[model samples]
Target: MKTRKIRILIHVAVLGLLIASCSAEDGATGPIGPAGPQGEQGTAGADGADGADGADGADGEQGDQGDTGTANVIYSDWIDSEFDANITDPAAGIDLDAPGLTQEIIDQGTVLVYGRNIVLPSNEIFPLPQIISNDNHGFRVNSPENIRLTISSLNGAAVGSRVIEDYRYILIPGGQPAGGTTIVIGSKASKQEIPDYSKMSYQEIMEFFGIEE
Candidate 1:
């Protein structure tokens, strides 16, 4: 009876040992599982503030002044003339009133006289000291009072009254400056090279002085 009881106890102890050994040994790993669904995207951040504006650039330089113009010139309208038969000695002379022709002007300024004959079809303009046919036409300055116009015969012929019909004069404020000096008259400056007014034609003189015809 004692041996049978001991055998039963030994069999029970061996079964318990086998069950513990089986639990201690690990089994082979299984295949990986399928991935889960992706999460929702986060909301975007607010926009940043705008940057400041740039400064303006610097200003440009100024330009130079222009040259002066001829504004000190004085002129006169056409004056009528008729030769007197009574004054007929050396030449036929006529005196015209010229109150503005001062002696200072005759010395330091310029005075130009021109003659025109209306009888001719072309109304020819002639600078004083001009000769027509056998007649010599000229002018002499009788300063501070009058200017004298004379007609002399070259061939000893009688001086006629039909020579000159009208006369005009231009008074420029400045004359030929001495020693290439600049002449300034009442805010007006004269050119260094004064023009030879006698050499210039009537039309050229009018255009140069900006005189209206």
Candidate 2:
């Protein structure tokens, strides 16, 4: 009975050991596994917030200035052809008021001093006369169409009417030949009676031509 009991105990212990060994061998290693299933994609993050604005910049320096402008000439030239030319107006290029007007007269041309012995302001304009007459102390026939009279006072160099001591006139001989002729009139003021003609201004010249200055 004792031996049978011992054999039964040994057999049970051996069977327990064999079962533990078989369990260890089965858990030790395994064959390579098949590819795993694909994982799900992660969610995207939110965008970052905007930054603050920067400070204002300083002003730039000024640039250099431009150069000065020049003058624009309007009317310059006078009459077209000077010699042997008939002039109807001063704007035609003949400066009638210029000295030696007889020479300026074109060949057989007419010189019309429209207003003769006419009084006007120094700033007023008179028309071109068929015959222009200058009045000094008295009317002396200076040319065929010119007379010289005198003014007691120039009225401070003003162009206007003036009282004189004596006044006289002489008619120009009709049909005077044209090429070049000069008419000159004189006055005998005795240096105490009336003013002289030497003192004249540009305004006076403009007035003689009936121009507004």
Question: Which candidate wins on lDDT?
Answer: 1
For every candidate structure, what is the RMSD over all alpha carbons to the true structure, in angstroms? 13.8, 24.7
- Each model's C-alpha lDDT? 0.73, 0.32
Tens-digit lDDT track of model 2 for 1-213: 999999999999999998888885578677899999999989999999987555667445554542211121011112222222222222211222223223223222233222222134332322322122332222222343233322222233332332121122111122224433433333232212211111324344334333332
Question: Per-residue lDDT tens digits of candidate 1, residues 57-154?
Answer: 64444444334345767677899986763335447778878756777767777778899888899999889888887788888887665788888888
TM-score list, all predictions: 0.58, 0.24
lDDT, model 1, position 115: 90
- In model 2, what is the error at residue 85, expressed in angstroms? 21
Q: Provide the clash count, candidate 1.
A: 0
